[model samples]
Target: MNSDPNNQNNFEHSEYFDKENIHHKMEPVTAAFIALIGIFIFYQVGGAILTILIFGFNFENADINAMRLLTMGGQILLMLLPTLIFARFVYPHHITQILRAKLPQAKEVGIFIVGLILLLPLLQSFMILQNNLLEQISSTFPLLKQLMNLLDQMDKLLEKTYSSLLKSHSFFEGSFVVFLTAVVPAICE
Candidate 1:
């Protein structure tokens, strides 16, 4: 054994826990590209899952409640998986730091809720303007019109899915649906 203070132990001088001095094997640009690719692939996979579950099963041929459940699963995959992968894999060491995951103060939470409520109208206005602009552009361009039509159909499908999900006869059923659709996703994200 070495008789020097620097040679006290192999683990003591190791760079693994020395995060400040750590040099990641993956470059920032490479990590970003990986994240983007992961997001794109996961989104497509989620969409494919939704399509197979929804159209393949033929929701109209079965119970709408079942269709709603399938849609909820798809939504979970779409919203959660990519986020988790990007957080854990792309930035493994700094997951919480990257996500800014921390418990906010009550005042901060209240402010955030109030800010969101105030901003809703502005967001809606922006969406309305965007839709109007797209419509105007679609009218002038044939390809754009087709794209817009496709988007419109998708929107209608989403509305129908939401309706199916929200159509609850009992208070307990409604509460469960709200918790599933809103609370769970909010917590996951």
Candidate 2:
């Protein structure tokens, strides 16, 4: 058995430093707890700060329309910044190791594409069925009807500008708006 420092006991050191199998490297429960705390703090405190900054601590029914745009931009940045910072600083090593896994095979990618193509129509059909069921239930259930009324009240609280922004659309136009709202945010994020 060669006892030279460089040649001896390669397996022993390899076991200690191996990075390929990241699933084995479990995150501590404490870390998860801290991450949750961080998220809560980020959201609550960040939202409060933004509200105060934009609206100047108004308790009454203050007109907030001018602040609404700034609020949206600030809220988005606040939400994403904490998560990004935590992931980068607190667990960079673990994240990088996990992301080093092999890329999806061509067949897997093709199957995923086919699955999505099939899924869209099925999802839309499911949603239509769900809406019909809700309508039927609301006819019988006063509570469900009241809930729908409450939702309508909430919608009315939004500005006419926002309501108009939402309502000025055909099906294709609505789909395009939804796609831009969802996909652009995801891509930018």
Candidate 3:
């Protein structure tokens, strides 16, 4: 029956702010809406600025390296920056807790490697099946066949562009490429 606002025990026993099972202050639905809006805005704004800086009104073709950098940088900005902002300033959640992330033990890593090795044949079979299905569908529909050919051309062009960006002549360059393409994206997510 203590009527003291400053009593530490009061907060400990409160129903709304339970010390035992406190959760994120922001509602899950609100957080999801904010996340979607943040991503949309960040992608549109960041891509525009990058394009202006790199291309400068020349939309015909962009340098492969510049395009690669832009794509990676955009993802970091759109995904990682907003999440960090919300976690630190808005809701102030622990990074590990919010992300549900932890460094896996060596045994976990070994198990993952074994799983991938065991699944390789099945994964390959699925890829082949997918391609065969696409081919069959395209053959049945002339319009779809034309559309598929166009998509294939576009895919090849993109593949070539990405390959050009990924080509690294030296060890340091290769490491940088991996960092930009793999490490940075993983961290952003």
Candidate 4:
């Protein structure tokens, strides 16, 4: 019968805000959309401003190490931060559960490693076959070639960015590159 919505007893007894249960929070799709918007705003706007502040307008010509640091920082800020925020909004009290706040089992780790090793050759072979098929199809369809050209431009840009980020000047730089490309994304994505 408490009139105040902020009353602890009222919130505690409310089915929707039950502390013991993780349901009745925001819709998963709604939370996903919010996170997507956050990613766009953070990556496109905040990231651009940060880039300019760090390397000025000519960021393309910035030092490689600086660019690597920027890429890592941006991933943490724009990707991981938004994801955490999404968890907080959707599962307030159960954020850890939502984010899988636990170490993986050794068996799980082994399976993941073995899966990656086994999948690589299969994937490479598939890619070769796919490319050959696509080439044949594109030869008969000019529109497909134009679409492929657009995709190739995007792929080239991504490759250039990855290549730039992977460059290292020392052992420490190489270690950081691995952390940035491997560890950070493993946690973020």
Candidate 5:
């Protein structure tokens, strides 16, 4: 057999380790905890800070399109970028596998489309039912009256904001909203 250490033929005969990969450098649980902390810090807390910096304390007067753009930026920069960099450090050799960096087959895509189409109505109905149940429970439990009132106030504010975000005046705007609301989350998640 050839004796060159770097040769492919010697792989079976010799134990090889890629020193560049941090696969054995950290415990899996430690790595996962670090990842969670990183996500929370950069995406959750940082996104909130960034929003406050740009939009001030009140979210009421923020422009809808700009808010949508900021949300997309947070997904890409604060969330996706850091996850990618961390994966590169800890899983350089298996980066693609770590990130699921592969296109699905057409059949898989079709099945996902069909599943989403069927699930949409069920999801909407569940949301409506949840709201109705919340109303009934709040009345049955007087202690929950204040909590329900708070929710009702916030719900009205949120509904107006979400309605503006979801509305589109033209086809291009609708496509952008779809990318912002759907495609970005699908990829980032």
Candidate 6:
């Protein structure tokens, strides 16, 4: 193992109990609460902005299919931007510490790649299961149905934005254009 400044001295001393070396030692419950709040705020603000940009600006009664495509493009950006920002700035230390801990291990890298490949199918399965579960719950519970309705409203807002955009350009072109807009800011940042 290579000697890392963050972990080497502690390993030498065998003082594994030391909390100082741990990155972000806040309680899991506290972190979960914060994450929920963050999700709520991000969805409300990001969803609103995406809807306005995609749907509100391109006010017309033309091609519905085109508008659908643009709304999808907007939704993708809305979902991705928050996650990228958090990873790059708000939680950069976590990524650095993880990389340092794992540091250039061929076996670890191989395992990680294999795990990621496996996870793709698992994630799709999970999404399918989540949708089915939500459907069942909505049928059984009024509150679940209400929550689903709220989600539907958000989806409609996103779709309206997409439809507006599609009216102007092909779906691929619109997505590529929006992606370029995002990339410029990312590069500058």
Best model per lDDT: 5
Best by TM-score: 4
lDDT agreement of model 1 with the native: 0.70
List TM-score per model, in order. 0.66, 0.46, 0.66, 0.67, 0.64, 0.39
Per-residue lDDT of 27 in model 3 = 78
Alpha-carbon RMSD, each predicted model: 8.2, 9.8, 8.2, 8.6, 6.8, 8.7
| Predicted candidate 3 versus true structure: per-residue lDDT over 24-111, tens digit per residue | 6687688878878877787778777876887776443777667767778788877788777776644464444445454666898999
| Error in Å for residue 90 of model 3 | 9.4
TM-score for candidate 2, please give it.
0.46
Clash totals for all candidate models: 0, 0, 0, 0, 0, 9
Per-residue lDDT of candidate 4, residues 57-142 (tens digit):
65457888778878888989888888887788778777755564445568989999999999999999999999999989998999
Q: Candidate 6: where are CA atoms >4 Å away? A: 1-114, 156-178, 181-189
- Writing each residue's lDDT as its tens digit, candidate 5 over 1-189 gives 458955644543433433344354466678778987988687989988998899987788898889999989988988888877877777767665445344566898999999999999999999999989988998889879889898889889778877888899999999999999999988875
Q: List lDDT for all candidates, in order.
A: 0.70, 0.60, 0.75, 0.79, 0.80, 0.59
How well is each residue in 66-159 modelled by candidate 1, as lDDT tens digits?
6656656665677576677656765666665445444566898999999999999999999999989988988999999998889988888768
Ranking by TM-score: 4, 1, 3, 5, 2, 6
Ranking by lDDT: 5, 4, 3, 1, 2, 6
Residue pairs whose backbone atoms clash in candidate 6:
54-161, 55-161, 66-166, 67-162, 67-163, 67-164, 68-163, 70-162, 71-162
- Point out where model 1 deviates above 4 Å: 1-37, 53-57, 75-86, 90-102
